[model samples]
Structures are given as structure tokens and as C-alpha cells.
Target: MATYKLDCNGGSGNSYKLALYLNCAGLDWQPIGVDFAGGQTRDPDWRAGTNTMGEVPVLEVNGQRMSQSGAILIWLAETTGKFAPAGTVERFEALRWILFDNHKFTNNYAMHRFQVSLTAEPVHPAILSFLRSRAEASCAIVDKHLMDRPFVLGERPTIVDFSMAGYMYYPAEETGFDIETDFPALHAWRQRLAGLPGWKPPYELMPVGSSPPVRVVTQTA
Candidate 1:
């Protein structure tokens, strides 16, 4: 049995991405909580000692530490020989969708949700509106893509599904968008992912609360 430790907080969709994969794959792992709500990642010492990039969802296993959710997901699939995109064509296809997810699908939505539900101070309504619109546009593309496929690649679930489904499980009140009614295809896709073995919602697996954020999201100077 391989032991895996993931550094994370309950409120992080990025962290949840890895958590979801580990659970669904039936791996032996536990979440190592990071005090993200307390400016822990912002500290230079913590960054130097843990992750130089200063982010959570650090996967520690067999004396190796890995960051970046996308990279780690690929590594896990490769090492375990599970969910490793069927072939060359599917691999490229997975890469394309994962890039889109990181750049827009997850990024825009996370920003919008951070501003609306996590920030200590209210964000300007105009900025919020812009982010919301961008998120919606990206969501529309994903919903359309899912309309003809059960998963991103086809009938089978892959890393692309995990990457894109990162924020879909969060509450509408938190994300400010309800896929259940607003994006039927996306909702159905996530429902399918949820039914897989070892699946658990983000907060239920992590040792923290989803509200008020682990810490007020801020840019480091």
C-alpha cells in the first residue's frame, strides 16, 4: 500500500481536484491540512520549506513532493496505470481541455467565487460582473462539449473530466452559478462523476470548512 499525503484546505477547488482523483482511484491517502485561511502560504519560510511556489494540494509520497494539480494528476495516472487517456489522440485531447480548464474554466469561476463569497472586503461590482461573464462564456463551451459526450473524451472518464469537474461540485451559493438548472449537460456530467467509487464532496474529505475561506485570497508582493 502506497501512503499519500496531500496538503490542502477545504475551500480550495484546486486541492479538491487531486483529492477527488485520489479517492475515486481508490488510493491510500490522507489530506494534510494547510492553514490557508491564516496566511500560511504567504509566508516565505513556509514556502521555502514546503512549496517554493506557495500553493496547497502538495502531494507527498515516497519522499517526493509534487505541486500543480494538473501535473500531479497526470503523474498519478501514469504511476497507477489508471485514467491515463486511452492513446495518443486522447492524450492530446486531454491536454487541450486541461489547458482550457486552467486558463478559463476553473480560473474565471474561482476568481468570481473568491470575490463573491471568500474575500474579506466586497469586490467592485463591475469586476465581479466581468469575471462572472467570462466564467459563463467558458461554461457554455463546456456544456456544449458535454452534450455529445458522456465525458470530455467520450463515454469513459479521464483526467480531463477530473480537471474540468474541479469547481462543479461547489455550491451555487458559493460559486454564484447553479449548473443543476443553468447548465444541464455539465450538471449531468458531474452527477456521473459523483456516482463513481470512493467519491466524496470537497469539504467532506478535507478537515476544514468551506465558508469564509481558509484565508482572504490576496496577491503576494
Candidate 2:
């Protein structure tokens, strides 16, 4: 079995994506806790030694340090031949969804979750509104797409599913959107993914930032 180490915290859906893929794919992996709330990512030595981008989910595998959840997911899929797109057409299509997910689907919603439920500092109502509106729009698109398909790329689950599922398992309070009622299709889709073997919740896999409502709240000033 190949061993993998990833910088991870429970609060990070980005990290969850990679962790989820590893577990579901039956890979031997370990979570290396990062003090995200303790300013570990901002530390210069940690940055230089691990990931200069100062991001979690820095997967260390085969003597390589990989960053960016999408890229890492793609690399994992290609290397493992598990959860990969079928052909070139599916490959490009999966890329499209992954790109859209990173840019719009998870982007604003993640920031919204942080500001409203995770951080201790006060957030402007206007910012919250903007983020929510953008998030809702992207979410609607995803929900509609999922309405017809079992997964992102038809019947089989792919890396695109893992990518899009980054923030899906978060609580309604944290994400501020009750997916069960708000997006029926997406909620059902989340359930389907959860039913897969070797699946576990974020906090179960990485407990670095498990507590809610700030979890100490030292960052994001």
C-alpha cells in the first residue's frame, strides 16, 4: 500500500476533498494536523518547508508536495486510475465542472461559512449578502445539473464528485444553507456519496478544527 500524508484540519472542506478521495479509494494515508487557528500556515518555516502557498491539503506523496485541491484530485485520479474520467471528452467535461466548482460553487460559500459561523470577528452584512447571493446562484446550477444525474458525470462517481462535494457535508448552521430543503437534488446527491464505502465525515478524519463558532478564532482579522 502506498502511504500518503496530508496537511489537514476538520474545518477545511478543501482538505476534506483530498482526504475523502484517499479513504474512499482505499489508500493508506495519514492526516498531519496543521494549526490553522494557531497561525501555522502563516509561519515562514512551515511555508518554506511544506507548502509556500500556505494552504492545507498539501499532500506529500512520492516525494512530491502537491497543492490546490483540484489539481491534487486530478493527479490522484490519474495516478490511481480510480474515480478518473473515462475518456478525453469526459476528462474535459470533468475539468469544466471542477473549475466551475473552485471558482464559483465552493468559493463564495466557503467564505460565507467562515464569516458567519466559523470566525469570531464581526462580518459586514453586505459582504454576507453578496457571498450568499453568488453562492445561491452557483448552487442552483449545480442542483439542477444533479437533478438528472446520479453523480457529476452520470452513473459513475469521478474526481469531479469529490471536488464538488468539498463543502457538501458541512452543517446547515456552518454553511447557512439547509441543503435538505433548499436543494433537494443536491441533498440527495450528498446522501448518495455518503453511502459509498470507506466514507467518513470531515471531523472524523481530521480533528484539527473540529469545534465550531470560532474554534478559538485567532485568524481572519
Candidate 3:
């Protein structure tokens, strides 16, 4: 058995992706909660060891530390030999979507949600609109691909599903869009992920009610 440590904050899709992967793979790991509200990620000990960048979802394995959600996912998949495709092209495809989610989808949607829910002041209309459009467009691309298959890789779930599921776990109401309606295949895929053995939400990363409620929105096609 390998010992793994995860430093995480609940409600972050990035963190949830790691958690979901660990559970689905039946890997034993310890989770360390970081208080985002109190800026605990910036603490001296955390800065020196687990995460110098002061970001959540850092992973410590066999005395080595790693950060960044996508990087962690890829490392875990490769180390465990689970969910990762064996073929070179398929593996490259998985990595492509993982990067797409990080740079294209999450950057826009997560920022918009964070600003609207966590910030004290109103968000700028221009920025909000731009982010919302980006999110919608990203979803549309996913929808087109998902329309033909149950999973991004077809027939089997891979690390790409794990990566994408993290972002999709949030209700569309929070992002100001309906996911199921926008991407029915994605909605079904989420249900499939939930059915996996040992599946757990990002809530394990929090101390209890430390995060906001996930707003629910009906999917519209």
C-alpha cells in the first residue's frame, strides 16, 4: 500500500478530481484540510513543504510533493496504472482534454463562480459576461463530443472523465448555465461516475459547512 497525502479545500473542482480518482482507484490516502477562508494555504509550513504556490489539492506521495490539479491527476493515473489508456494516441487525447479543462473550462467558470459567491463586491458585467460565454462555448464543444459516446474516450472511462467530472460536479446554477440541457451525455456521465465504488465528493476536504451550497439548475437543451 502506498501512503498519499492530499491538501485540499472543499468546493474546488480541482481538489474533488483528485479525491474522486483516489476513491475510484481504491487507493489509501490521508486528506489534509486547508482553510481557504483563513488563508491557511499561505502558512509557512505549507509554503515550505506541500505547496510553495499556496494552492489547494497538493499531493504528497512517498515523501515527494506535487501541486497543480491536472499534474496530480496525471501522476496518480500513471503511478497507479488505472484509468489511463495504454495506447499513445489515447493517452495523448486524455492529456489534451485535461489541459483543456484546466486552461479553457475551469479558468473561466471557476473564476466566475468564485467572484460571484466568495467576493464581497459585485462582479464587473464585462468580465462576468465574457467568462459566462467562454464557459458556455466550452460546454458546447464537450456536448458535441459526448453526444456520440458515454465517455470522452468512448466505451470506457479514463482520466479525462475524472478531470472533466470535477468541473461538472458543480450545479449549473452556480455557473449561470444548465449542464444537462447543454450536455446531456455529460449529465449521464456524471451519474455513471457517481455509481463508481468509493466515490466521494470534495466535501471531505472541508471541516463542515465551510463552503457554500451548490446551486441547482435545470438542464436546458
Clashing pairs in 3: 181-219, 181-220
Regions of model 3 farther than 4 Å from truth: 204-221
Per-model C-alpha RMSD: 4.2, 3.5, 3.3
Clashing pairs in 2: none
For model 1, name the residue pairs that clash.
Answer: 37-214, 37-215
TM-score, candidate 1, is: 0.93
Q: State, as a TM-score between 0 and 1, how close model 2 is to the true structure.
A: 0.93
lDDT string, candidate 3, 97-141, tens digits = 988989886776677676555565556778767767777787778
Rank by lDDT (best first): 2, 1, 3
Q: What is the TM-score of each candidate against the true structure?
A: 0.93, 0.93, 0.87
Candidate 2, residues 1-221, lDDT tens digits: the string is 34898888898999999999999999999888888878888899999999999988799988989999999999999999989999899999999999999999988778777777776665777887787888889989999999999999999899999998888898775677888998999999999999999899888877764334443322222
| lDDT score of residue 162 within candidate 2 | 95
lDDT of 2 at 213: 46
- lDDT string for model 1 (20-93, tens) is 89888888998887888778888899898889999887999998999999888889888997777978998888
Instruction: Report, for every candidate in turn, its global Cα lDDT versus the true structure.
Output: 0.84, 0.86, 0.74
